[model samples]
Target chain A: MGDSNVTRRSGKNQLLDLYLTFAKIGATTIGGGYAMLPVLQDEIVTKRGWATESEIMDYYAIGQCTPGIIAVNTSTFIGYRKAGILGGVLATLGFVTPSIIIITIIAFFLQNFAEYPVVQHAFNGIRACVCVLILDAVLKLGKKALTDYRCVLIFVAVLAAALFTPLSPVLFVILAGVAGVILMPRKKPEKTGDEKASDAGGKEGTS
Target chain B: MILLRLFWEFFKTGLFAVGGGLATLPFLYDMSARTGWFTTEEIADLLAVSESTPGAIGINMSTYAGVHTFGVIGGIIATLGLICPSIIVIIIISNVLKKFQDSKLVQKIFYGLRPASLGLIGAAGLGVAKIALLKTDVFQESGVLAQLFDWKCIILAVCIFFVYRKLKHSPIFYILAAAAVGIIFKL
Candidate 1:
């Protein structure tokens, strides 16, 4: 069961190294999920050799599809591959350490000074910018998600339902997933099978 | 007791906020409506804070929300609650379902989930737009149609959007510039 011979470091050191490396990645990455990819490629794939490029891509695809934060999920997958459960746990802990530390400090100051007029003005501007950011995110995601008429229909339906009803967003997600599973299979038997294959190849296979 | 509720609330958020960091916005909006722990305007601030910070926006947001509610300990609990699902789910997939990503079932679910996630995000975006771009409280008070709109913010948002379409700068730069505009123009 002892496979530490492949790496120069001892088992304990390897786990610690995994933690510290992810901590650095977490501490430095200023953006969101995809932004961390290049850093992961450099640190984990190239520098550490913990995972191959293709393997990293695979983790990212699965990570994006699954629940929770994409960055944290990718770290867990890589850490699990490198060491085991403990390694995965440590890597996740390391990745979140900087966030908790940094945000806690900032949150403290923000709470205390939020009443100041200068701070309020700054937040007012920042809030406007934040709206633009969200709209941009929606635009980017729409390009990927609304690939076809049916997908667009789903998007519209979901939007209407979510906005009009008091039903939980979670219900819509689950229902849409169920719709996908049921609806996608029907397209397979039609002449559109080739198109389905290509779409799947592009979206699911490579992503 | 409140700590448990916070953990449970965020745990649900982490589990269902499926697409990415901003996908969590819908859930956060729901939480604000339900709990009254933070206002809708505060969520826009949280987004700005999360975006400017050096970490996953999702983690930064949960930490900020937690700290707002119950201080450092609450931040810890909320963060732990958020990551708990990731650790367990990732470990399970790695151990048992090595080929999970390639499965047809998983692909189909993602196919449906993505668009729905987009809808949620778009809806959340509109919610924020109401707070940031519209002066609803002023409109209510003044009973004037002109007072319904914050022309400065609307102009700023339009300018920022067009500039972003052409230039494609980092979000931090836009945020900093917007803040400067707010300060100088008192927007």
Candidate 2:
């Protein structure tokens, strides 16, 4: 009984630590899920050692392929891995609570603020910058996505399809998956799923 | 009833919005056409707001959309609805997906998804570029070369794009700088 109680206390402490860490992350992650990459390396991998670097990349890919927000999904995956269902719940709540509170406050005043000139102008200037931010993100992701000559074909085809056609991006994503299964050269099977490829530059861990 | 519908709509969005945040743009457009809860122009604002804010852009926009149409309760319900799929899906995957995690097939699919996602982001970026730089309405209205684009916005966007290369700070920094410029220039 004493041992069980001790375990419970430590577990609670870990959960609390997890919550505080993610709360700060959710609050300050300016560029969204991808932005959380560097933070995760710092907090989760380097600081906490809760997950290995490759696992985070794998989880990121999983987060992307699965439904829901990638940030929420990845956080949940980490939370669940660390502390089971409740851990998952607390971590998510922690990650999103800032957004909820802030967005709620913004929503409360936004109706009134929407028509104000300074607010509108600020939004205008910010919108132009938002475009640049998106461009930056695309360029970064492009480096990862456009890794090879054969991949170039898939990249161009997908880009043109997304740009001009009526085809849904979702459909393109699915089709690309199929193409990947078929077209991407089948690398020799690594003996273990979790085996860290030593040559990997850890680019996935970087922002 | 509207809350329920908002929940259902966002639930569908969360279920299918593969890729990332901007991947939900098409779904948001669909919601606009089908429900008329928010207009296209309002969605543009939501996009900007979502991009600028902390947290996941997809959830922030959905929460904002719900609040815009339905209020605080709507925001809660919409957020819960959107994340439910993720929680459930991750729970299942975490438990059962270990064996299949390393298959060549899975790797290939992700191999495709990474660039496809980039391509999709590029397309979305172009859409934002149109909204930010081009005054398409003016082009349609006046058919004048000078009136085709907002020169100030274009210049500002170019400046931001280049400046971003040098000052790779947090997004909030650039956003605030632009806001300051906006207030100073009344952009």
Candidate 3:
């Protein structure tokens, strides 16, 4: 829908634009997810007019809900909307290019120096910060995820299972999806019984 | 063969790690536990590096793990493996379902997935806590209660946590500051 300007431009130029824009965003943003959002909005929405703000939010929503890294997912969605499959692939490649280059260099050096006393000491501190950052993420995510008691129940159950059992996290994700579909509609019926009931029943029948 | 395994593992990670970059931690921990490709401590190191660095945290971590395991080429393979799912899924959604985000079924599945992913992340946080806050090896060897905790790390973690909560600086700032503290105190 927003490809009018893109159509006027040559395919090669548009693709290069998509790749370079995302590569710049990827290189500049320090943290992923929300941190990347403002920069993404600036470059893709404000600067380039590739997508509207609302559309970017939609992309983010889907990006969060679906699998894979959110930044890459959003980049792909925007790129696809801008051009096509080639656009999507190029954008994703552009997004991760900086990461590959930077991390490969760091990993190359870190591996060699990893055993050194000073590097080890620095890593010890960094590890503590990792714990802190993860703790912050859990709190933020928990606020969003644990909305009701059902969600709280799932959270506790999954946490217990994760710690104690040998079950794969992949299994947990799938099971939780099933559980959500089964559990959520029951809550909806309290507000509008007939409509939701039939809707759920119809969906269940189709599947 | 190792590279293939790395690809497959990260592919699955990309496929199932719902929510965001941090969600990949549990899968990485599982990968280490199963394959011994790297240690939990290494994950912590990589996490720090990933957080401070540019680009997506998931891509950075995967690249780091791949490089740590197999070399630079391994990093490339693991990264490609991780993004393959996103490419396929996003393209399908873009071509097929314009209203996929508004679908009730999609919302329902995520309703369940969100908390479950949180639990997985919480468990991963505990894993990092173990590596960051405790000295299991010293405890195992000495069998002393006092030896169980690395008090300095515990103090460092507590201080960093509180300081972070109060200051609200970017994660990189705190991480870099903590590294300075570590070097100064030889933690």
Candidate 4:
């Protein structure tokens, strides 16, 4: 009974710590979740040592599959890993609170204020800049994604389909997923003794 | 009845909108087609406003749709409904995550998901490109080239690209700069 109580208390404390950490992440990180990647990496991996780099990458991957926001999904998974359901709840709430407050305030003014000429002009300019930001994200993500020939082919096919055909984006995504499953190279079996010996000899001089 | 229906509709949207907030676009477009609660033009406008605002695009669009459909109450219902799944799933996953943390199958599932997510992001990039580069009814109709291409937008895109590359500045800086240019150029 005493041990169980200690466990519960420790879990609660961990939840609180996770909430505070995520709240700081939400408040300070600018330019949305993608920009928050390095900070999340630093806090979760480098500092806390909660998850490794590959594990964080896995979170990013699964986060994309699920709904809401990538950052929220990541935070939820990490927080949950650390504590439990309560921790996940607290972490998500902390992440979204800022966005909620900001949006509500903007919504209040948006209807009437968006009509103003200056405001309209400002939005136009912002829209233009947003195109740049989106493009930058694409370029960066593309370099990471399109490392091999298969990925490059998929990229080209998707781009061509998007540009030329009236294909639905959703359909395209499903197709690409199918293609990835079908086309991704299988891991090869371990080489025979001779090949292993040659590989070791090749590496010996370089090292 | 109305509130329940509103909640269910948003719940469905949230459940299916994989990839991210922008993936909600096609679903919302389908909703507009079916219901006519809102027009395509309004949907486009909603996309613009939602993307520009300071919240998750999915939530903002849900709020817009809810407000359009059933006013303030609808907005709250829709928001709650949309978020419900995430809350529930996260809670459940949180409970079981530790046991499955090192599972190979789970790892492989996420590995497959990375490419899928990249594909969706690519598709979204294309959608935004269509809005940014293509001149629709927003510009006057003329020849095919004139109808499709907006030189002004292209110029702005190029300028912003170079500025972003050289300065490596924040998005807010670009937003402010673009606002200034819009006022000066009347674009």
Candidate No. with top TM-score: 2
Q: Which candidate has the top score in DockQ?
A: 2
Candidate 2: which stretches are off by over 4 Å? A1-66, A69-71, A74-88, A187-207, B1-74, B94-96
Instruction: Give the per-residue lDDT of model 2 (tens digit) for A66-108.
Output: 8878888988999999999988888887888788777777888
Which digits, one per residue and each the tens of the lDDT, describe model 1 over residues B22-99? 778999999999998889998998887786666899999999999989999999999898888988888988875567
Across B50-151, the per-residue lDDT of candidate 3 in tens digits comes to 866778889999999999889999999999999999999999987765666456776676667767766765776777678878999999999998999989
Candidate ranking (lDDT, best to worst): 3, 1, 2, 4
Collision count of model 4: 1
Docking class of 2: acceptable
Better of 2 and 4 by TM-score: 2
Of all native A–B interface contacts, model 1 reproduces a fraction of 0.72
Minimum summed lDDT over a 10-residue window in model 2 chain B is located at B116-125
Please write out the lDDT profile of model 1 over residues A57-131, one tens digit for every residue: 446555666789888898999999888999999999999999999999988866544456776676677667767
List pairs with backbone clashes in candidate 4. Answer: A125-B178
Give me the displacement of residue B21 in model 3, in angstroms.
11
Encode model 3's per-residue lDDT on A71-165: one tens digit a residue: 89989999998999999999999999999998999887655445577867876876676676766756754654476898898888888998899
Tell how far residue B73 is off in model 3, in angstroms.
7.6
The numbered model that scores best in lDDT is 3
TM accuracy, model 1? 0.62
Which lDDT values do the candidates have, in the order given? 0.77, 0.75, 0.78, 0.62
